[model samples]
Target: MTTPLRSLFDFNGGVKPDYHKDASTRLSIGVLSAPTEVPTELVIPLHQSIGGTPRPIVAVGEQVKKGQRIGDADGDVSSAVHASTSGTVSAIEMRRMPHPSGLSSLCVVLETDGRDEWIACQAFDHKLATPQEIRDYLRDCGVVGLGGAVFPTHLKLNADRQGGIETLIINGAECEPYITCDDMLMRERANDIVRGVVLMREILGAKQVRIGIEDNKPEAIAAMQVAVGDCGDDLQVVVVPTRYPAGGAKQLIRVITGIEVPHGKRSIDYDVQCFNVATALAIYEAIGLGRPLISRIVTVAGNVDAPRNFDVLIGTPIKKIIAACSPLPDTNRLIMGGPMMGVEMPGDEVPVVKATNCILLGSNKIFPPPAPEMPCIRCGECALACPADLQPLELYWFSRAKIFGKAQEYHLFDCIECGCCSYVCPSNIPLVDYYRFAKSEIWAREKEKSLADEARDRFEFRQFRDVRDEQEKSARLAARAAAAAAAKQLATTDTVAIPNTEASTEANEKAALIAAAIARAREQQVTATPQNMQQLSAEQLAEISAIEARRAEIREQAKPHLPPDA
Candidate 1:
């Protein structure tokens, strides 16, 4: 059985703005039919969530089924992207995104085949799956928080790191003015939301589940009460006072649980975690029907003849949504969300992504130009209206002077950019704009510093490598020279006399010649030519004369032949 409602708590500061929610929530959510004049092509940006951009898996000209995975999750922090309807992949290229910055991102453009066919899907039972398995399943289903932040839902469900979660705070407090998507969702699908909440309670193993909805949404409150009563769980629907910025995660946590999450500390550190009502319903859809997050309910309001909400596909252009609403002829500005925290679109041609909850069309009639910014009068009104209990005036001064460090020290990032300070500023100063500029500058400088640090690391490593290489080269050369020296020393020490290879070879040749000459001298006897004639026998002397005669004859013959030839 569910427990009684807990005592409500008050946050630091908040404002009561003119709630323009009735204009859109008066009627039930409208179902948009397929475009008749032209085929509605969905341009799903890969970076719909708050983490890394998903990689495109479907290429141009490839056929994709409705609910088919077109983009795969990039990392643990990212969510997957699926086709909104069965279609042919037309173009996977850069297209204008639905962000206030007016920059482009990689988008998968799919032209609907008009059949709205579906791929085979299997429903999942959370009881049968492990915690990690459920998380992986949610990641693959492209489920994320639909509450403006669009953070991946799987990461939020990781309670094991938090020493086990104590409570699960469901934020149904749609406190932002003119945003009725969540309010209407709770009213129409309260049972589904309760089921999703139960699933979350099971996932977190929390002692209790408290859904914080603003008291302003009575219909939603009644519907949720009925659903919870029927479910018979300890899910308590706590009604919080409707105030601007009460829907913020930390603020909602405080109002519901009476715990102020300190700056730089996550809510889970306090044994608590939070999720949005719309995000819960998305979780239910993902697990119950195996459906991926391809579409969402967008509230189209402000300066329109028929301000209503529509169940829009993920990639429908804002222009088509405005056309459906019959926007006023004087409409000049198209904002992607509520006026308090919404981003003004550069043009209506941008496609809606997961973070888009409201498309507020405004003109001079609805949102007149702001009063000229004046010098700060040192009034404390901005600080009084700040929900985070920050000194807006001090933040403004630091941000205006580009002194981002001081602004951060004053908890500028905790400001939430809720525009409460700006709304209450008497000087009409765009205090939120200054804060945003300061934050952006700080981020850019941090990025630059990070890159510089990486470059320095690489340079230092290169220098170390060069020194090591030089030392190695010197060592190798020294080793070679030492080896040669050792060889010479060994040769000198091992031999009695070092053999002079060239001199020894020459001496041996000379000795060999002398020996041969000596041998020839010993083998033959010689005598003087005049004295030897007396010693010669008569026959021998005659033979010698005959021999001389033969030699003279041969010489005459040779001389005649040689002269004739010449």
Candidate 2:
């Protein structure tokens, strides 16, 4: 077995909250990997990643097998979405997304056929394929960061720049309370994870790799070490202190590599890259088995009698998953992620998307409401606990006062919303919530500014086009007038010398041709008859002749008594 790394570094400021992971880790995920029973329906959301939302490729009533692409990746920046199981598309309509905003978005509702059939899968030969080809393949395969970020994985495979990545860090910290999907994954599927790590390292062309797990997960660390035994000397399993939010990419990188990546700068700039263990497993499956990501391991704990981790389909309803967990009474709300950073879902019926790592059922007993807000006494507890080394009090004050510019100036976006600041604040200011509000307002304003710029550009273009059209029209009129004046001068002036007899003959010939054309046109017009009249019956012809004769006889009689002009 590979030996764990002894050298380790530390970062400034982090809290050690109750992990609460043991409740779900007691039993293996195998019992709930694939439930004996199936969900009646799977409402797969089209937008699951950080980039553009995948466009729906399946129409209503269309049958799709498991792992079949139901939503095509929008662009290189996006990831594809797939049918969780064999099913018929019942609707392509708006459904509530599992987010803190409780917003509804486009979803492909599927009525399950209960077959759980899969589409044909062929492994991608990354050895023979180019980097761009591999990225495109993974994007189509629906591979993304599964450790709650849900960033399209193919984008991270890019090793084209950043002075080349020398280190690849696999994050198995799972630092959030009550979330053990990654921990369980490393414990059971370490071999598969190792295979994925090798693939990722090859993709990034990294020379060395480090897998960092919290010291609390001894079993996971042992299993991963055993599996990684013969990989290479460059790859090591590093045990890190179990601290809340240590699993943050930057924090984990700091603890393992001593690389302090700033907010704006990227880890790749320091020749380092990080991936979650679950994300590694996903990469392995995509390149090895060719199966797209249609399911994930989700921890359903808190306010449940028997908390467990389940391998849930991407679009399976949370309520359906909860039904299996024997939810305890007084379960007030359903949270879609870990306690620290997870969003309280709008409803239990919200289907799990790719970002869902845990389903934290909340109640007053489990997560009691905070006491009434109190004025801050300039306490530095929040600042002390901040892992990013940011001043939480200043951010809180600016956000509360609606001073977004000051908040942003204070590096508001750097806050990871880990809830550490809020957890430690004596005044119970809900510091993270205020920070989140400021960030959202800033984003909304930026979006508006972008839209306004686009509209202004369109208006200016239209004005320019109108002016251009008018200028062209004026130029055309001037040219036409000049042409007419030149023609008149040419006709009036003796421009060419010719014999009188020849000129006369030419003029006569032109007149004769004009006359002949006009006569022919007149003859054709006169001969043209209405189709109805031309196809008259014999009785209609006879009736017309009799009427003509009667009219003629009447005219003859009237001529006898009329004047010569009449």
Candidate 3:
């Protein structure tokens, strides 16, 4: 009898397209020699992952090592960056980065010295460490998902133990076309990948370990099977049918086991935590060898003379990688990452970031140019192909009208931008692009709102300060009045006899001086408008003159009674 379909819990409705993964997977992973002249100017984007941007730790002209911390994770939801090679920080300024917008971002440029050196890295005793300790160590080592998302790996592994994660799924499904980094990694470093999975199992207290590989990569499957044989029955190697996007965390979870991760729920919620094969290798390198993630396997393919997977250092320039690959004549489009999710580069000056997975140089003949976008024809193909089961047509309508709030109401944030909708769109509408635009617009508005809120806070704080100052002035005036009354009472009780006429004259003179000062202060406080002053009417000027004259008379009356010492 034939075995039942392994992926019973996989959600219905997914697109299956030709995945040309054989280009780079045919060759074993080759160790890339450090470029003789590593690009001095590195463009490190602030957003290299799914969480908060890291804060730069080094300034211009500061020297950094291969594994030295250059930027730190800002909060619980951030990832850190390490220097790819020993180099001096040349600059920290905004430059064009490898993003969908071709936008400028704050980047740290490093001038490498060619000598690949490392800084001090701490290693933990795995046997003696607690779950929290393991998580902390992974965080410090800059361990994150190597499957393009770049989520901090420690956070995923540190799920609630009460949930009881029984199985650890190692995703070896390199399903993206023309990208074979993960496949090559498993074939070349299968033992390390297994060790990483075992390490994860130890940390998560997982009972069983399952390695899932697509049947297209029989070599990788055979290699992994051989590697796990030494580890015994706790580890099993399973081959699933080749399918596009089969490597997605949720898809792989469903295919390997019959457990479905509910909507808006994590795979760990179903007692499963899926990790990419490359990520497992990185974890093994980090924990076993006490090394941070400084390098990764990158597939350099498409319209190139050499299509191979190389273990390239992070922060390597795109120009350098292209130069190494030696693209064929008539090369036009240069995209970073896989063909489906990769972003086109404006120029070759943009340096490689932590998320640079593949560099595809597409030529006219090999890779046909994308056709012009046509209006949606309401075919429902996008909905059928949607992995998340969202209505792409509805989203397209809302996004075009700039109705972001309504788009969000339809669960716009759930879109992973996997390009399945666009891939299957008969009209070639670029549905994913529209969704991305909508999301970006929403984020921009949110940022503006935050800034406005901050400004309002500052304004309120200033008003509060002014009110407090006024209250303080009133309190001081009250205290002075009370003190003056007490002094007058003491003077009346004292036995120092004086002429009442002289005392009255002295008091009158003091009152005249006080009245004159108060009149001057009131005059300074009055702001006369040009119109009002010009059209001053005879009555207004006469009133001012009368007040002046009365003040003069009062001064004259008290002049004789003024004390000689006053």
Best model number under TM-score = 2
**Candidate 1's residue-wise lDDT over 1-566, tens digit each?**
34375688889778899998888988898866344422468788888898898999987999998889998999899999999888899999999888878899999998988888888888888888877888889999999999999999999987345445788999999999999999999999999999888888877888878899998999999999999999878788888999988999999998988899888999988989899998999988898878888788999999899999888888888788889888889988999889999989989889878899999989998899998999999889998898888999999999999988899899988878999999999999999999899999999999999999999999999999999999999998667555544555465566656456867645544554566568678766453256668888899999999999999999888874556557
lDDT of 3: 0.79
Residue 352's lDDT in candidate 2: 84
> How many Å off is the CA of 490 in candidate 1?
4.6
Candidate 1: C-alpha lDDT: 0.87
Clashing pairs in 1: none
Cα lDDT listed for each candidate = 0.87, 0.87, 0.79
TM-score against native, each model:
0.85, 0.86, 0.80
Q: Which window of ten consecutive residues has the lowest lDDT sum in model 1?
A: 31-40
**Model 3 over residues 1-566: C-alpha lDDT tens digits?**
11224543455456677776776676667666365655655556656766887889999999888888887877777777777778788898888887767888777778787776788766667778777777777776788898888888989877349645788998988777888888888888888898888888877778877888888888888888888886554688878777667777777887788776766788876788898888898888889988888788888999888788877777667777788777888998889887778888888777676677788888888768779888889999888877776888899999989999999988888777878888988887888889989999999999999999999999999999999999999998667655554455466556754345856645644554566569888887785444556777899989978997999999898778858897
When 2 and 3 are scored with lDDT, the better candidate is 2
lDDT of 2 by residue, 60-123 (tens): 9998888999999998889999998887999999999998889999999999887888899899
For model 3 the TM-score comes to 0.80
Model 2 C-alpha lDDT versus the unseen true structure: 0.87
The parts of candidate 2 lying over 4 Å away from their true place are 4-6, 31-35, 159-164, 230-233, 495-566
